[model samples]
Target: MTTFYSHLKRSALIILMLNSFCAFLQKAHEITYVVGCFENGTTETLLEFDSDEVFYVDFEKGEVEYTGPYMPGFDPSQLFQDLQIYKNALRNSKACKAIVAYGTIMEKQPSEEKDPPESILYTAEEVDKGVENSLICFVNHFYPPLIKVTWTKNGQPVSEGVSLSRYYPNQDQTFHQFSTLTFTPTETDIYSCTVEHMALDRPQTRIWEPDFHHQHFELDVFCSVGLILGLLGIVAGTFLIVKTL
Candidate 1:
């Protein structure tokens, strides 16, 4: 009787082990089809379907085994959505480096928010006239490593006055490349920074108007008053010397 009991226990253990192994094998092939299924392989690939929208095939029961209820309604292609996701991530980076020097942050998704797509950069101060105007621009993706940064005044392209910096890496393993377009625009003119980068889903843009440009009228007024006072002093000195002599 004890021998029979031991035999029963061993059979149960073997069955349990087999069940676990079969389950593992089933899971392995379920997701294997998605490894290289981007653009020319599988239509409903990994990044394409959201949670619970995946399909798997299994044929192991008898003659032919089928699995899964094909989900209803066709979803749009995932490649477009994937690019949009990446585009949004970069835009929301709030890198200060990403916006126009004089313009506020533009539209972007949360992935690029003020955190470290690069790092917590040296926060820029508000514009101080005659000191330096910090550049804020949206990087226009051109190629992989090379990009062009140029200034636009009232919709005209400029050359020879732009600055490009080395690309930095973000915490997310992506790169933070920057370029600047510099132009001293006037109130009557509109300035925009155009960049063509390689990583953006599409061309990114940030525009600066007269108000956002931070041009200070008070400074101009003070300089004008000083000039006038100096000229008057010169005139008074010339008259006084002439009279005394």
Candidate 2:
């Protein structure tokens, strides 16, 4: 009777331990994630996947960042849907850091979404049809970094007789992108700026001055600018001369 009673007690304890272990496994399989946007910017964390490759990044890193798994296959997209909760997750999650090592687990990459570089349209001080060599101005409203400014004439890239200035940020938090192209701009010439970025919808601008002002306002503007420059030069030269004396 004592031996039989011992056997019964051991059987009950084994069953209880098995049930508890199953409950713990179920809880571990639950999925959880977090998304945060600090002062630097916004980002998402995809937790506990089979792979550990960091796929996406902010694209302002001075290199064109085009990465990620865009196509959604049945197995990959479905399995990944369980954990990824980014609104633009699949689209902006293309970081190129995936590789197979020791194991063949699939992975996802991170992508950056920067404000698209604005289109540049040439705006002149004049507003008429025919005039001689008017001052050509390129005006574009940008959002900030991750952009390169270049000028093209007649659809060909050119760098001669051109000038570029640092971006000016407005009080309202908009970026002002400026580049100047100097040439004998003719009606047939198409002066434009090409902006390069990671997005397929990058920047290719064609400023149509089809019938803009051509009045010779250079003298007035030139005189004003010249006077200021002259005065500055005189002041600087005077300071040097006085110091030498």
Candidate 3:
């Protein structure tokens, strides 16, 4: 499925400043209003404070949802006095539908360009043998916004503790997504994440494995050096005491 969006934004700012010889303080806050219409006949209206979502209109349920904490001294009722925001969103959706229909009839649809995705696989924390950790698969910069992600351990499919996130839009109009797997690190286990999308001729895979042997070797060398130094220090102390006596 493909979706096109018509976006509109409104902003209000509040600034306060206090200046004196001893101290100076300034505080500035902004409220953003956004309305959008999707090609699938869905509409979204949002109110954000400092880029954090505070309120959104749920057209399907015919209600306004409070998505974030209440802001002191800000009254949401004022914005919905006559439900004008909802009405505007409905009108915008209708206009978008009409435009899409006209474009279809005229054979003037948007360009069908495909952008391939880039993916990376990494562990959430330092990998240690027998330690529970999470593997993250990040995929970005893909167009059309549909992709499949799967995980495998030691060449076998892994289903438990796998999760996929919703698509997030990028500034270039492409999209990004994330998938995660929960697994325990082992010296002999290998993990892989595979991503498949329409833009790719074949699926892409990333692999990860633990470096337990390397880490253990480094630790052993460190401990051996420390033991040698400790023994030399004891011998030198004994020699000093006997000569003084």
Candidate order by TM-score, decreasing, is: 3, 2, 1
Whole-structure CA lDDT of model 2:
0.41
Score each candidate by Cα lDDT. Answer: 0.37, 0.41, 0.70
- Candidate 1 lDDT over 1-245, as tens digits, reads 01111112111110000001123545622212121111111111122122222322121221111122344664333324444433332332232222222122222221221211211111134543334444555332222223455667678875556666543222232334655554443457666665554344554456665553334566677899999999999999999999999
Give candidate 1 regions above 4 Å deviation. Answer: 1-134, 138-146, 198-201, 212-245
Task: Look at candidate 2 and tell me the lDDT of residue 166.
Answer: 40
Regions of model 3 farther than 4 Å from truth = 1-102, 108-110, 221-245
Measured over all alpha carbons after superposition, the RMSD of each candidate to the real structure, in angstroms, is: 25.2, 22.6, 9.0
TM per candidate comes to 0.31, 0.34, 0.60
What's the alpha carbon RMSD for model 1? 25.2
* lDDT tens readout by residue for model 3, 1-245: 22233221100101111111222257566555554434454445566665566677777877677666577877666656686766766675566566545544555445445778999999899888788999999999986566899999999999999999755545465668999999999878899999998789999999998888898999999999999999999999999999999
Clashes of 1: 20
Name the TM-score of candidate 1: 0.31
What is the alpha-carbon lDDT for the whole of candidate 1?
0.37
